[model samples]
Target: MARKTLRIAMNGVTGRMGYRQHLVRSLLAIREEGGLDLGGGDVLWPEPVLVGRREHALKEIADRHGLTEVSTDLDAVLADDSIDIYFDAQVTAAREQALKSAIAAGKDIYTEKPTATGLGAAVELAQAARAAGIKHGVVQDKIFLPGLLKLKRLIDGGFFGQILSVRGEFGYWVFEGDWQEAQRPSWNYREQDGGGITVDMFPHWEYVLHELFGRVRTVQAHVTTHIPRRWDEKGKAYEATADDAAYGIFELDGGVVAQINSSWATRVNRDELVEFHVDGTEGSAVAGLRNCRIQHRATTPKPVWNPDLPATESFRDQWQEVPDNADFANGFRAQWELFLRHVALDEPYHWDLAAGARGVQLAELGLKAAAEGRRLDVPELAL
Candidate 1:
């Protein structure tokens, strides 16, 4: 008998992330001319069954994509027995509600990161998914980046033997919403809405650090709002309450320490490098969005204070461009590939809601530590 095609329904169809990350990139890639190369063999490809969103807006999107299956009703989509997966990319506060409803409807689930605004809610969602016997996953895109994949390879190969410390630099200045058009969404600068770098990005770093080093044991952090006020896309000014920058120190279980600096207030330099510098006894490696570099102590340089001396060679020369095998190899797309494989072939993939919950837990701990002016012992996010 021929296997059934996985009928996937995108819940937040008109949202930027839903359209850009999944629909525009992932689904488009599966088409013959989209460069996906999925037609050469007996490889199975799941088709997007439908997209659900607000009526008028979704109509425009559906027309643009030439998709006939579209609906404005969430319940109608979830209730459809033909749907095999429900993918959610709604705002943070609404994600739990939508996901809970999807799980109740007995659909397998996949969603964007920072699963919920709070740790308890995230955990509950995870538990609910488990109890419902549905496959569940959270998008952890960083791990699939070819640069990070190279870093993982180096780590597993013991290239950086006896690791000592890790440093992460993440940032790029977004427009303050004043004269220029606001670079990011308005919801990103408000507390009432599910906005804040602490929630949005820390979970990303949490997974990266945990994957590279080990489980984080504790955190001491400081968070700040660099730009106090900003204008919206409509030129209306609004006060920014959310912390735009977060600086934290993480204590890994094996005594390895990691320092992370995440912000939206820095100038764009070095190709928006969200790079990690890992220092170890034997050698060191640096991984960024586009490249990975490694250096060993064997050819390590000696310090000299000569002002006229040229800059010494280090990990820069070892850098290489990450290969892109599929359209999903960028952003959340790669994570999508892994999830699809996991669903179709029962392949092992690491990004899960449990790990995503931990990212939220880490951020929560960091925020608490900042508020109370004390170090916080990180709690394990259970499966």
Candidate 2:
């Protein structure tokens, strides 16, 4: 078997998500598995070149993983013709310039979404990638989640005759760094640092709703900073300037109405950190990160509202679980595999920079709608 290598310049792996999901779970996993089988005796391998501002952190990662390439100079890395791809998982404020630099260097581009801080910049990145004639992709990892995969199966199988509505609850309390160390980075709570629940989550919602049900036509939202003060990485107190919560209503193309409440301030009492309850003409389903349960219209229970009577039925047990018919990989890794195939074999790939731009547009519009206290139409976005 002949081996082929694609040297990749990876930025921002020091961040939690970038390190855990992309570097460890995805790329390294591929390398450990002896690369992806590209058929015809050619095996595609990914060689990661760790790139970051922090030398000590990057060196630590390289030493820990036995990776050979490490660089702080992005321009120097870009100038290398051996580097096949440039991947960015950096802070939103810095992503635009990095992506443009990668594009100019003629590298195939892939990155975490909200590709830029604003819609216009996102559109520009998409245009640049297109003009460069290089393969490009965005990480829309939620679509590959097992629960949502089952939901997609249901929809495709026509189990849901017509999806009427969707309601979702997603959140868990993040311990303020004062009492206990915050699980998430403190920068997530500062607006000036390009952080907020609306900016962070609405993009996920845009694709989740669009890919699962229909195109989101309009958005109405109430976004607020539920936590006004929190401690940072250094344990110093700072005024939290970003929204920690957002309540959103989206009208989809097929008259499907969806309402979602996203928060970091609320404590959880649900089965999962995030769950979406979908209602349809013939059936209904509730899907979380790993589990999905469904109740057909015929099996749905009927209960009379009587405050005086104790409930006899267990509503939770009424639905049937959706079995995992196929083995599933980490959502991030699964997307990575597809992207590698797309690049190596010119496979049909749809989730590109354009999709990412739409996500950014939705988040931007969501924030605007919240500020204006109005329902705003989501016009068709074009490059």
Candidate 3:
């Protein structure tokens, strides 16, 4: 059986997430694995053409990855009739315009989250894609994480009976960039560049809580610019205007409450950089990026409250590690495969632009709730 080739125009392949996750780990990996088997003696092959402003960087990436196509001309690539999908992993502020152009050109779209810097722009993009009758998707990669998948399995298996509350602690101390270079991009510290913990992380939490538990109804948040100053890529001091940390309490449907703390100023004290503890009536589970530990009510230990005495019991030992009963693919790669199959086979994909718009709305409202010092209701997007 002959394999059908799907041409993909990938913009922002020069960036970190775009280069490492989307290009190398996902698309290229798919190609290396002899493309996706669509079954019934048919296969779908992905041929990605790197599109960016830097020809040198694009060429370098193409050469390094054994890719044959590299084009700096986005407009020309969009105009080409052969490209089936146009993917955008560009910066938040530039995403809307590029996506609009792609939609206008009658191309299916898949993009990284936030979708756009503002909710209005994100919704408008969603509406445009819908009006154009194009298949569109947003990267909600966290749902594909191994640990989260385990948590979902537990929830689905009725292990977590009568879900109550969720506590998420996500953060790590990013270097100040004075003595050491910052791990993240310097643009992440600038508000004008669409940088902030609320914008960056709330979208993630929004989908995570909504998909895992229920849609978020109300949000109360506190955002702070913990690190007022930071060094840039050039080792020059710059004022960090964006909020470095955000504390949020979300009220989900079904009376489930979720509290999430996201920060770049805090040090890691948890098992992973990000971890969520979900407590239910029957059991409790703590999930990080790759591992999950559960404590059933029957196995839960009882301890007398005594603050003065030295703690004797090993609290961490009470929980049992959840076994990896299933093979776990890379989170981003798994989502990429799903999206590819969706585009190729016309599979139902719920994580569309409108869903992404909801994520942006949550972030927008979270920032508002933080500024106003009050709980803000998350109204459903009309799209």
Candidate 4:
């Protein structure tokens, strides 16, 4: 019946994703709700110890949020015996060492992906966490998405019989930052900063594919920097050294082919910024972030290729929207809550650092496949 407060040393609160999703939406939201329910009158509360480079920004956020604990010194924060968890949403380059430090400090590790800039570093970090005997998790927020959840339901229920192929499109135009301000951080365009569509997104694809459908057996990709030049935040022109777009073909288990296109240079033409169309023998589904529509084989419309004339069929009307049967919470918060439960009670959490390493491995191979211009086997990672 006692309330337990978990002190989370959150690194990277100054950044957009770390600020919006992790800090404001997930952690603070959980705190405002009087903590996560641990059942039987027990509650698990989270107190964030904001950690970052900028003291002014950290102080501003803390003052704005009525938080007291703020520290720029990560080592000092980690050295504190009270800090129960270390959550990293920092830039990829900084993540590996920070996670290693956290592991050394014996704090529960939760982090944003790809866990590290490279597969070797990620696996080493994972191994360190495992050796330290600490709880660990990676942010795989897509799995908890309403649309993807529904798609998973369909898969589990055998709605998609003889699952064949998956087509995924994810992107939106990020302004080149010449005339207009870019939506994303400027570091996203620099290869030295660990910024690339393949590195940033392939881990996400790996988790999604591995969790919902199957493990990625093979990867073939074409990655390129569509926008060669871009202006930075200070309106200074710079070469966009990182890849902006990637076209990938992942061979999943059971011979399911998944082709996904991820780009920051492309304009949005689809219903959502991201969508996946899965076709099976029994049915087909088109899923966005929040909505999923399905077309059964029974109701499959037969149409002839009539490019010579105006199309008569309303092809979009054929599929029915999958109703939201349950109220869905914010994906990030849902995962965070599960992570809390996992930390508190040692619940079954599959999205560990090793899984994160696998994601990094997949992405690394994806980039390699792109460079080689050949399909590369995604070997089973052991860490």
Candidate 4 shows a clash count of: 0
Residue pairs in collision within model 1: 177-231
User: By TM-score, how accurate is candidate 4?
Assistant: 0.99
Candidate 3 C-alpha lDDT tens digits along 1-383: 87999999999999999999999999888889898999898888999999999999999999998899989888999999999999999888788889999999999999998899999999999999999999999999998999999999999999989999999999999998999889999888899998998999999998999899999999999999999999998999999999999999999999999999999999888889999999999999999999999999999888999999999989999999999999999999998888888998998899999989999999999999988999999998898
TM-score of 1: 0.91
For candidate 4, write residues 1-383 as lDDT tens digits.
87999999999999999999999999999999989999999999999999999999999999999999899999999999999999999999899899999999999999999899988899899888888999999999999999999999999999989999999999999999998999998888899998988999999999999998899999999999999999998999999999999999999999999999999988898899999999999999999899999999999989999789998878898889999999999999999999999999888998999999998998899989988899999989777
Clash count of each predicted structure: 1, 0, 0, 0
Candidate 1, after superposition: displacement of residue 154 in Å? 1.2
Local distance difference test, each candidate: 0.80, 0.94, 0.93, 0.94
Q: Listing every candidate in turn, what is its Cα RMSD in Å to the true structure after a full C-alpha superposition?
A: 3.0, 0.8, 0.8, 0.7
User: In model 3, where do residues sit more than 4 Å from their true spots?
Assistant: none
Error of 2 at 218 (Å): 0.3
Q: What TM-score against the true fold does each predicted structure earn?
A: 0.91, 0.99, 0.99, 0.99
Tell how far residue 374 is off in model 4, in angstroms: 0.7
Q: How far is candidate 4 from the true structure (C-alpha RMSD, Å)?
A: 0.7
